[model samples]
Target: MNSAPTNYKAARRDPHAVGTDSGKSTRGEVSLSSPDAMACLRRIAWLLFFTALTALGGVRPNSLQPPQQLIASYNDEQSATLRWEAVPGARLYRFQISEQRDFTTIRTDALLLPSKSWIRATIAGLEPGKMYWWRVQAIGNSGESAWSLPVRLSTNGEMVGVPVERLPADRSVLAFCSVLRFSWRACDGATSYRLQLSPSPTFDRQVIERESVEPYAEVVELVGGRGYYWRVQARRGSESGQWSPVQQFTLLSLANIADAAPSVKESQRLRLLKSDDPVPVELVPNPVADVLTVRTPPLHEGGSITLFDVVGRQMLRMPVAGVEQAQIPVGQLPAGSYTIVITTSQYQWVGTVEVLR
Candidate 1:
């Protein structure tokens, strides 16, 4: 039969001592129910619980909250920038972009540390017009927390080229408007446009900079009777064009749509190509400061050459008798975007021209 040991006063009273006789006067005798032994058992059980938690799926300090208000914007059609709120005490962050919500086809997995000032990442080589989803996870010594809520972003699909007709035609006087919506024609396979709104004519100091997949953008928060300038440029994948000429419009209490529309009717304008495939007349000195030359034509009917503002206002018109094409003077025309309409009695050929001074 096992004999019960006698308790040592110093050792049994100590709850934290490692050795049963660790106290100043404690000896080797210690009872099984001593406080020191009980404390040791409790410490072992706590350690076991902690080890099990780390090995299992229970990460410490609770699951990380979903990325705060994830925002996605595109500087180029093939690339995007993502921004999120930084998580406190997160030593590591993992961001993933995928074509599918389930992340079956992952495009990018960006790793970031908590010390970063901005919790953002720029991902490139993405397809335009495709739908993508992104999520973020916070990781620390304790383990990884739950993934953030997925954010959906639809990439821009814009046309490439210079802007065409605008809501407020060049040199337009507004009747009334609090918000301005600028519209332009779309080019084929274009992915996006860069826009600038400025208070100055030269756009030296722009008030707004925007990138949009659509051909239109609406700007708000403007004071009445204030004149503003705006311009846009478009780009495709791996290619881009120059910025368009600036157009100015003044604000007022009047908001008549007709006041902003071009003087000429859009639907009434006739546009005919050489053979319907390849363009016929290619305007020479495209950014014509003085005379614009119209070359290339099988004009059979002594066509007349006419230049119209972007809004469709016929700016210059000259009758051509025997020549297939001719040089037209536009020195008197204001600096803005224009269209060259070369109409022969047979077919009306349409082309684009710009006046830069």
Candidate 2:
């Protein structure tokens, strides 16, 4: 039989310490049935269970949430800005850029410390005209989170001499009209042009498309009360150049002219009129040559009269100065249909006039 432990205090503190009393195991052995010994064994078993659960994919706080809303915008032909929503409690972030969607190879791998709700990363040294993929991962005290969904972006191609839009200025607002005009500078070596209009900036869906030899085009009967985006592409034979930068405009209904026009007195003779309402202005000589005359009812306040070509390029602008009649010289202009915009203190009018040689 083994003797009783000599160091009772030490044995109570650590059951394993009881195996050797006075530095010799032959002196005494601890009783496993002791309350302290049983408590120590339970703690060891609990630690083992917890570690096994962790290795089996438990206690994953990072995987429950990750960065989101990844968006990329080109800063130039060789660089871009990547941004995304930050994850709460994230201490650091890992962002990667890759040429392959599956991320077989990484072009950029970087780490960042969380600072705000939105995180921004600027990446450079990219090749033009190539598509790239990017994603982000958040890391916290627990572990690293799953990667965010990737976003794809393309760099601008060789569009050095591409056409530039001239008319229907970007982000312009216009009143309700059946016809929409567009114009762009002519591109060299281009035999034809393609004009496209869409409700999306990405041009995923096009509502209007026209092919023309000239640099200008027109679309009619586009519904008002919405916004539209347009771009132009130059083509020569079978070759085509990249699309020009997009331009956007919003069209409002004539009844809501207050939004498009300056505020005017309600009692003025040139009161705001509905789209179907007729204006009191008239143009003499349907196909005008040399000189065109605009006749209208007497106006209490002066307004401006303007002429626009098929491409919505302004050809003439003059103040009516409260006059009932105004004359415009069309002899120097090219033969085509032009739009006339008459704006008074209280009303606005849009009409088409045919100019002759």
Query: Whose TM-score is greatest here?
Result: 1
lDDT of 2 at 353: 86
Clashing pairs in 1: 158-190, 158-191, 159-190, 160-190, 175-254, 176-253, 176-254, 176-255
| True-vs-predicted CA distance for residue 11, candidate 1, Å | 53
lDDT winner among the candidates?
2
What's model 2's overall lDDT?
Answer: 0.64
lDDT of 2 by residue, 55-173 (tens): 86565655537688775545566666666777876766677777899998665555555656666665556677788788888866565688988878666454435687355656555
Residue 337 shift from truth in candidate 1, angstroms: 42
lDDT of 2 at 249: 70
Tens digits of lDDT, candidate 1, 1-357: 022122111112222222334333222223555545555665575467457757766566545554565655555656666666667656566777777999875544545545434465555555668888988777665666788888876556554467775444454444333445677777554557788888898878757888776877767766655677888887664456667888776654433322332232344456654335476566778888856777766555555666666665454555566665566655545789876666665556666777998
Off by over 4 Å in 2: 1-64, 158-357
Off by over 4 Å in 1: 1-62, 69-82, 105-110, 115-117, 122-132, 140-145, 151-195, 198-226, 231-357
